[model samples]
Target: MTEHDALIFLVALATLLGMARLLGEVARAFGMPLVVGELIAGVLLGPTVLGRALPDVFQWLFRQSTPQKMLGAYTTVGVVLLLVVAGLEVDLGIVRRRGRSAAFTSLLGMILPLAGGILLGFMLPDSDMKNPNQRLLFALFIGVALSISALPVIAKTLLDLGLFKTDLGLLVMSAAMIDDSVGWVAFSMLVGPMQGNSVEFHKLLTMGGLSLVFVAGTLTAGRRGIDRLLTRFADELHGGRVLSLVILLALIGAAITQALGIHAVLGGFVVGVAIGDSPSLREQTRATIHEFVTNVFAPVFFASLGLKVDFIHAFDFRLCALVFAVASVAKVLGCSVGARAGGLGWRESIAVGFGLNARGAMEIILALLALEAGLLKEQLFVALVVMALCTSLLGGPAMKRLLYRAQEEDVVALLRRGGFVARLNATTSRGAIEELVQILEPRLGHLAAHARNQVLEREQMAPTGLGDEVAVPHAAIEGLEEPMLALGLSSDGIDFDAPDGKPATIVFLLLLAPRRLDEEVRVLASIARSVIDPRAREQLMEARETEQVLKVLAESAQRIAEERRARGPALADI
Candidate 1:
């Protein structure tokens, strides 16, 4: 409340944010996630490195001030917003479409680690447990902690590896989505009991029931209502107004959940899911909110972790290693086995397992919450953070290496026999993807359904509609020797959510092989460039036969070749 406190809080905030951001950018440059650098920043600024080296300075900044409480309130908002972003990333529709594979992956992926964590919790000596009396609670916390996946990190890793739109990527993403959903729900339910409530059998049972209802209601009724509200205000909700609305709803949701004896993060998460599910929601708006929250609030939240604990004192290498080993083995094996059961190739299945193994920021957030709630001790919290950082570092490179292979090929050459659908009867995106996959069934065989799921999954991530009535639904598949291309011409023209709001008459379903990211980009560019001219598009549209469409494509390819040649070999990287 004093001016001195305010001055210290402001100074501390500035230093933490500045140092964290600098390191985050440095981490990005080195191909690591921002959290890795942020963690380092925390260790350096907190009691670990800084306190040891500069005791007086650390004391003056932290010991003399009552800024920790104020920082806690600020970080609470930061965490709420972060969870909202996490919720926005969860696409329930993708999980639904993934169906059996996702179900199996999520179920087994969750169970193994959860069981492993619980067993680990029990096996550990009383010294590790914050309270030996609440061993069950501690065990359950560990279980939930180990079970979840960080959707943001997984998605980013896939994107960086150019697998975000691939069949393999979709499988990993869907499985993670389910794991996160279930894990968070479990965590929310346990938060109340772990914080202070009686750990009686009856109370836990009641909490479990309430949590289920809360999640179910939020996803079903709340999601629909939020969709309607966004639709009604789609005109007014833009720019600063939209940003304010997101913050407002997140706070309200957090408050409600907190009042319900659950963690406030649940409310924010549910609100995000609801807002995100709206068909009317713009990608631009989502990006704005994501950027603002992450760039500003996220750094503060992560940096504040160091101030709360002495990492050097709390860290137990044996325990940390044990947690990491159990987490990695359990998640990888469980997800891989389930993926194999669901018909993925052994290589692709294992890659999915690795992809979903990344814990990232989610684990840190969970661990921090449990520590603050008195459910976890500093030792376990530190171990969990280290585990998260290590797994995040491992997941991407391992998956990339596992599925590596691709090359540039002409779009025309990639097209298979009988791949052209003269008239597409389907109007909806879902229906169109299925129809295209059915055409691919002879060659793709069992993969037809998988292909369909990935295409739909990619579509949900972003609209594939290129302007001038051309739309491409595509994904790069693992273990593919070559790209697969199919064409569907819709006379009625189907909406593909293009920026121009134009329905696509020329729809191409393209499946690429992973690893040749440059080749993939060139292929997409080549396709988009084909219909760039109105005259060419008009000519292609008038042609009733497949040969006519081929002619246009061939001509477009010639033009592209000419352009590439003109650009000279020096510009090849571009």
Candidate 2:
């Protein structure tokens, strides 16, 4: 556009950003996801509120001219960056570490919702279909939309519950990651041939082939090239140069996918996955990208979703209810069934189901794509938005309630049996680990050497230090029949290369077989919750003897367990 349009666009951007952040903070204050408030900001600014109350101001601010197109371009860039970050967040290593349960849960989670969505698509009346001739295409979009899970939402939920680093959290996040990639790929395939109305089989195959080639080629050779570039640039050039290269790479990837006729998101996402999977990628590099994208691009993108739909005029109670019911029921049933089949108990399975059911930014992105592609009408788009918001709102509370009774049981019983050391002789993480392992050699027998090596190796992969002068070093050992935990206290603190850069004074060493992974998670959660209290940790640190240390541990564990039972197990809140 013109100079006038440019000025108005800047004004619109500023207003959107200000409103989005304010509302997002408000949502967080009430224990709701920040996206909910961002969404509300959009509604207040869009046709529903401002357009109705003050038509002249709304028209001037959000003029349906060149300004709208400019904003759309900005929104597109925001979406690309957001997808890149989401891709960066996916740790393929976590997927492998969580194992068969994650595989089964991810598989069934996609399959069931996809099936349900296709069924729903078939049942919808002709009037609701945006493109009546492209019924199959619309059906596929629905399947993909309903099948996908929001990684950010699920991660946030787990963080709130003090389970982000626990086995259960890892499993859920892994399964959701798989579900996300699969759904996006499926969407790319289905939406690839939506250009001219009549789905060209040959064109669809061309796009699909191109996508596969791009993903495989980039993941192998392209990944190495990107890694080398990052390493070289980081060593020679300034840190900001490396950040610049990352953004450049993301844009290139997005452009390639858009040219290939698939969505630009898939390209950015694939590149992100490759970068994240690389061993050479630095935490600073990740932080640089994340800080810019999350704080700036993400809020703008999510808020823009609200600006598109007229919530008041487009809101259909029946359609909203129907979409919500189908999406939630299909996801919960699919995930719960998958969890049970993978050998989880009823409660755990139910919790997993709820965890995966929360749909947030991803759903909004997909729905926006569908709306643009003529697969969704305004009313249905509104319905999908409502469904996504409701599902996201429902997940955390449901998980907390499902896991409520579980928090009452003995948390320190197994740890109390393993052993506790009041004074640790070592002043470094490796030395402390060796000392702890030596103390347990008599009880471990032949497995002690293997356990020690495994623990050291796991630490090398990623530091176990959890900050607050505490560290939990754990490993999945081959010979262990049940979970084992040992505690060591260092009065002067020891170097563990922790994220917080604080020396670790408390160390909880854990070893468990693959079969006892769930048990390991329970014990970790117990220790994690108990350590929330500074006095609890302080009491243990100050204890002069083993007997005093055990008493402190027992009392802290018991206090947390009782609080969990009386209220809810919200360790973050505590």
Candidate 3:
């Protein structure tokens, strides 16, 4: 409130943000997650290093409630935004596609680690718990902490290992989403009713009922309404407006949960899931929201993790080791068993277990909240963060050590029965996509709209125009069993915004099954190589009939297959 306090707050924020960003870049350069650097920045600036070395300087800069409060406000909004971004990664359709395997993996994954954590919690000294008598609450807190998966960390790991679109990658991601969802809900139930000075059974019961209603309404009616609204305003909502709308949604969601005594982040997360799942939210818009939040706001919050706790003074190696061992063993065993039950081979299942073992940002966030809530001791909090960082760091390398491969197919061979659009009535890109989607409607059935939207979303990310007289519009659709292609000929030509400013006379609507990143890459490569040439485009446009189009493509496919055979298996295969 004072002028002196205001000046300190501004200067301190500048220092934290600058240090965090600098260290984050350093971490990225060293092949570590940027959060690692950001956390380090906090550690150096906080009590761990700076306070010990320069006590007076540290006190002068930070021993003020006004600065801490100002910083807290930024971190709070930052965290809520981070949660929304995390929710966006929760693809329910991916869950459906992976189905039984994901369910089994997530179920056992949560159970065993949770049990191990509870046992570990009970065995700890009475004085070690934040509240000596709240054994059940502490145990439950530990259970959720160990059982939860960090989806963002797991995703980045999979991507780094080049397995993100493989069946195993998709499987791990799906299972992790389930684990994250369950973990957050369980955490809220444990913490929500205990917000006041006293904990009561009636309050817990009330919180439980309210939580169920919130989740159901959000997923069903809230989810549908949000989708329709976004669809209606898709054209109008851009850049600053979209960013503003997302923050507004996150805040509104946070308010609802915070009022119910649950953490505000859950509201943002639930809203994120709804918005992210909507086909109307283009990949471009998603990326914009993601980049801004993660870059600007996320570092500040993750960095604050270091500021709050002294890693050196509070760390109990014995306790840390015990927690780490129990969590790791329980999670691996549970997930591996579940994966096997879900029909994966033992080796692949084990690898999947390791991949999903990463606790990452989610664990750190949860641990901090519990610590602030007086449910976790400082040593326990340090141990959980250590475990999360270790698991995340190890997951990618572990998956890389294991073999990862997906079945590859030739796209041209699938045009035998259907997927051939000889002459298109639509002269615009959007109309072309709609017409093609309708042609494949019988096959896609309920997923036709989903297919169309995904294609449109991908298109919006980057124009698919191949720069000749050819354009390939494609998307990987969830639940689609196989690759489908619809070749549409436009005599008047349609503008696809190609690099060379050439209008496309031949358009290929390619639909690929989800979890086939390799297949998608190969098919696109084959199409670009075969049809992007001037002569090939002229031939395709000249022969606009279905039979002639098939003949030309079939020949091209044969030639391409022979060339690939001569060259041997690609580097990706190896």
Cα distance off (Å), candidate 3, residue 290:
1.2
lDDT of 1 at 416: 34
- For candidate 2, the 10 contiguous residues with the lowest summed lDDT are 403-412
lDDT tens digits, residues 343-402, model 2?
Answer: 888788888999999888889888998888777889999888888888888888888777
In order, the Cα lDDT scores of the candidates are: 0.81, 0.81, 0.81
Instruction: Indicate the residue-level lDDT of 403 in model 2.
Output: 67
lDDT of 3 by residue, 80-179 (tens): 8888998988878788877898999999999999999889878889878777768877877888889999988998886555455445677898999899
Tell me the lDDT of candidate 3.
0.81
Model 1 TM-score (2 dp): 0.79
TM of each candidate vs. truth: 0.79, 0.89, 0.75
Q: How do the residues 112-170 of candidate 1 rate in per-residue lDDT, one tens digit apiece? A: 99999899888988988778888888888888899899988998887666566555666
What residue runs in model 2 are displaced by over 4 Å at the alpha carbon? 97-99, 232-242, 282-288, 407-416, 420-432, 453-463, 467-469, 476-482, 489-505, 513-518, 534-544, 547-574
